[model samples]
Target: MIIQKVSDAVSIKRSVESGTEEQRSVVKAIIDDVRTRGDEAVKEYTEKFDRTSLSSYLVSAEEVEEAYERVDAELVDIIREAAANIQSFHEKQLHNSWMTTEKNGTILGQKITPLDSVGVYVPGGLAAYPSSVLMNVLPAKVAGVERIVMVSPPGQNGKLPAAVLVAAKEAGVKEIYKVGGAQAIAALAYGTDTIKPVDKIVGPGNIYVALAKREVFGDVDIDMIAGPSEIAILADSTARANEVAADLLSQAEHDERACSVLVTTSETLAEEVASEVLRQLEELPRKEIASKSIQDFGAIYVANSMDEAINTINQLAPEHLEIIVENAMGYIGQIKHAGAIFIGRFSPEPVGDYFAGPNHVLPTNGTARFSSPLNVEDFQKKSSLIVYSEQALRENKDKIAAFARLEGLEAHARAVEERFKS
Candidate 1:
């Protein structure tokens, strides 16, 4: 159904909720088991879920070499080129430690420090993609993380996909494990006999993986409890219906629950894009997935004007937003929420997903309103640097003591007073 007004758009329920309670319980049980049993639990869960038994969980150097042989040389070169682009884009985001000295001898700033290690979870089996390896690993590598550990489910043959291995290797990932699902997340959070615990975990996975991340949040840092992928296209009469339809399908094909939306000022364009979606959906190889997604979560909203369109976009806060209006760049400032805004018609959603330098692991399910796209900062920590001279300390001691005493923190007041006792 096409919505003709903003008020009507509000009433249409979007299926954007997280995992079910039963799924969460199952994930929690697995996590707790792994936390207690370590490799034993991981082995049991891997065999049960992945339908394979593994002697060793680590992806050995021999396996990585064999994976390279199995993959075509051309694909390897493309992954490397993409890696270079990702590295270049993230390099621009690297923040350095800085300190500022004042005349009163107070020095304050922040010290930038990369996490000691990180675990990257790559979805395996049918969902395995080399692009995921590149997107998840490159940022950690760019942030100067020393140890990069990766995990993916082994196939029924008990082997990691060659393309995934090649991508991980190209992205500078040093360690790889055969385990996946909630158990993989568990091993990363609480180290097993073989797998050492990492400081943080980052990547995309299914509902169980999302639940696992949520369960293990405090034990180890996670990128985000990522929801299903989503996209919104803000288009006008000038935008091509075919291009808009293709862009919407790109996200819809990822998952059946993925949201594909179009908010346009032109009702004619809205109807044209909806028809175009149906035409293209028939041609897609993943037509079953894409078609179901469009029928279930897809929407076309006709706004009164461009201002109304922009307002609707902000409310949705889609993981990916494509602005295909007459002056796409000019509308950028009006977009208050969106994980990544793709300006102009040529910049499709996949460009950000695979080729473009921006991280594809983005905030989803209205999270773009507050959170951000995964970047080098996710793999790093910052500590406030404060070096106060005697003069500075004395000058601020009275105020500090007064504030502390007001909060009933006498100990805190006394600590400051002790420094000035002499």
Candidate 2:
């Protein structure tokens, strides 16, 4: 890892990767075909990309049972516990429809309603991501979304990952489909013979999946167009070099484009962590990926002061910010623009990624400056409520009409005015 001054933090430039024109053309064609041909197009694309052909895309109960048999009992127990944690955490985010009436007999408030249905797309057919299942589904379930559908590509043997199946089942998803890629997103957005269209779609996928989501955005809602994983640690002299190095590599191992940075006031700590990162890279299973990430996007910045270091972190607006300083909590108020904030050495990035209660699906590529982690609100919609009494309408008709006329909406003005006509 190379070191630089905090002010000159140029190596870790963040940019969202839009697919090539060829990839976009392919994704658009797949979406259009699926919209027109429905299940037939989905099946063709699934066979082409996933190497699996399915008579019906829906996963059978027998297949789910088989998945449980493949996974260890202890691991199932763990998945259940994690789901419970996720559910409990998101339950706090739930809000009820509320209305307030004033003395003037006017009712004004907001009605909170959960989406009728949601589709969650889990990536990779051969590998399992039980955590992704729990993270994507549990919040929607907690928000009272009745129909939660899951879609993942199946492997060559026409079987989805056993652990992914177990996780979906554990997360209270009654509907699971073995279809993926741009076709799966299109099916979710536009409905098919076997699969029903959902109000919104959430979860991460490959470039084709991302582009399909981008294409179908107007017809249905989607989660963020997630960039590569990122972690920026704001550490001081008290932070451990090996632990800091390990946390940085945790994100780096995710993808070659994944970014890992450490901003520290201590130059010595910066040097030690850079060396430790290289030493630890050799032992990781995804050594090549991590090494390249560390080489290309990773950085160790030496800040002159704690304030400067904190400012650097805020400027980066990292997806995951770990304050590994001695008093991490005290500086949290000053540090803003992070998708998720992890305090102290004990609270690493993976803690929230896996077993921790918070949603790991977060804004990436400096989008944290505006966006937030996935939560219950994303699964619900709010409609403004207004019940104006006859007297109230008579009193506010002039103001309302004037406001509408100000916007050059004469029809809107007339509609409100006619409601109050003698």
Count of residue pairs whose backbone atoms collide, per candidate = 0, 0
| Predictions in order: lDDT | 0.90, 0.91
How far off is residue 175 in model 2, in Å?
1.0
In candidate 2, residue 417 scores what lDDT? 90
Model 1: residue 48 alpha-carbon error in angstroms: 1.2
Q: Considering summed lDDT, which 10 consecutive residues are worst modelled in model 1? A: 9-18
lDDT of 2 by residue, 1-422 (tens): 88899777664665466999999999999989988999889888888888877787889999999999999999999999989988999999988889999888999999999999999999985457889999999999999999999999888889889999999998888899999899999999999999999999999988888888999998999987998899999999999999999999999998898999999999999999988998999999999999989988888899999999888888899999999998789998998899999999899999999898999999999999999999999999999999989889888889999999999999999998997576
> Which residue pairs clash in candidate 2?
none
Any residue pairs clashing in model 1, and if so which?
A: none
Model 2 residue 277 CA deviation in Å: 0.8
Cα-based lDDT at residue 348, candidate 1: 94
Can you give the lDDT of residue 121 in candidate 2?
A: 95
Give residue 273's error in model 2 in angstroms.
0.7
